[model samples]
Target: MRRKSIQNWRRSNSPVLKRFCASIGKSLGLPNQVADYWDTMLGGKSSSTDYFENYLLSEIDSPIVIGLDHVEVIFQYPEIASNFFCLLRTWNEKAKYGNSLSQVWEKLRLVVVYLTEVYMPLMIHHSSFNVGLSIGLPEFSRNQVQDLVQRYGFNWDSDQIKQLMSLVGGHPYLLQTALYHIWQQDFLLEELLAKYTINVRIYSEYLSEQLSNLRQYPELYAAFTQVTNSPTPVELEWEQALQLQTMGLVHVRGDRVLPSCNLYRQYFNVSASHLQEFHPKSGRAEG
Candidate 1:
């Protein structure tokens, strides 16, 4: 996970500030004054709420939309993440509840994108984050996949498309990668499927890292191995199952866990006998 500090967001916004300052300087003929005070006015430590109101909203003539992606990075640092979220909640509340700062705070619209749900770690009340629009991205439907393939100029029959889906289970990333290779390298669907059954170079690093992470927690690794080797779905601890699901390597069906796709099954289906050999030395040391 990227351990970016909160200052990173402020740093990114610096360029926007500079541009705005330049325009203000040109209009008012005070470039020297603006340059001298810009650092003092914007750089000092303050509540995120104050920063949003005084700087972001005050400078812009129209509504300001702020988007933060991969917020999951903060999950590793729970206290910071919780405090940051609370600060956002405070900003949102000030807008909705009509505080003295609400006039400016209302101009700020925050769009946060994270891999997992924030409630899993957020310290504030659930209503804080729930008040805003929440959109859940769903996997692509069969028609969507077919349309994507057609756009790539692959005139595959239904059976071929089904074969590809069976291997990738309609996963957007895997399907896109497969289609990219087919379109760019002229690889046949059969050739791609065969490579996937053995070892897919495109997914090698990701697969390795996932496996390495699994080794860090023996229970998760054991659950993964059990599910991969089982012909039928197997039950795992709810948290373990969730961890696997979060990794996009397993799917939870009612009370059982199953490999997310045939590709995962083929690649991660390590038998108990192979566990010792496959375990990472770093994981062993930590253990």
Candidate 2:
């Protein structure tokens, strides 16, 4: 049960995830086809909210999960809000009977799921970027994460955690983004002392690398200068931002685009200005 709690919503082994497979199957109306359908879903590797809505939430003649209706509540349709709450109320009741599919279907399972989605992100919010980075690198282990946090003091809040989890779901890129900021801030040096700091050295080394990558990827770097030098800064397309984002040099925040982290921001601006000052003679892009 303890192991189950930590491993919630995480079922890699076929035999191990049998129960979760069974539960999801029950929710979908085909208790026996749980494993079969699950295998197919994973094999296809499709990521569509519509697929989840159809596979996990469509009206079915089977036991419902605890929070299905809450998804509906947040579903963003005014007409569906009342209907979703009513569906949720029924699911809550159906879960209460002596034969309550949910009550004994797995308490540990419920807790595991709660930890997997809700609690994990909440805990991650206040933690160090290295901690979040470690979480992403090591697949998904709740206790390992717990130990990581306890070993190195970190913090989290309810909302930021959830927002990040949903955005990246602990994927390496997104997790790294959040952590990059956190860790970068701590190691960063002010402009005066930064020249002597090892972090600056490392970042300067990294900036050099970015400079090298730009030689082969002019399309990506084109937008960086294009924005600052433009009479009216042009809107960058997603494809144009790939190189910048992948190298951790910049990020897109809504309509506004900026550097990936403060450290990068400082380094990028300083180096760019420096390049303008010295590039042989002409400080103009080659026509």
> Over the stretch 1-287, how does candidate 1's per-residue lDDT look in tens digits?
13344345345655433433344345433332334444554442233334445554566666666677776666555545565666666666666676776777777677877764221333333634576777867667789999999999989889988888888877787788889888887577888777653345776766676676666567777788889889999999887787777667788999999988887787776434455465655233233
lDDT of 1 at 87: 61
Cα miss at 160, model 2 (Å)? Answer: 16
Off by over 4 Å in 2: 1-198, 225-234, 280-287
Q: lDDT tens digits, residues 182-284, model 2?
A: 4557542123133435435434554565565554445555566554343332467865554354444445666656654344444445556666777635443
TM-score per candidate:
0.70, 0.31
For residue 124, model 2's alpha carbon misses the true position, in angstroms, by: 34
Reference-based lDDT, each prediction: 0.65, 0.39
Best by lDDT: 1
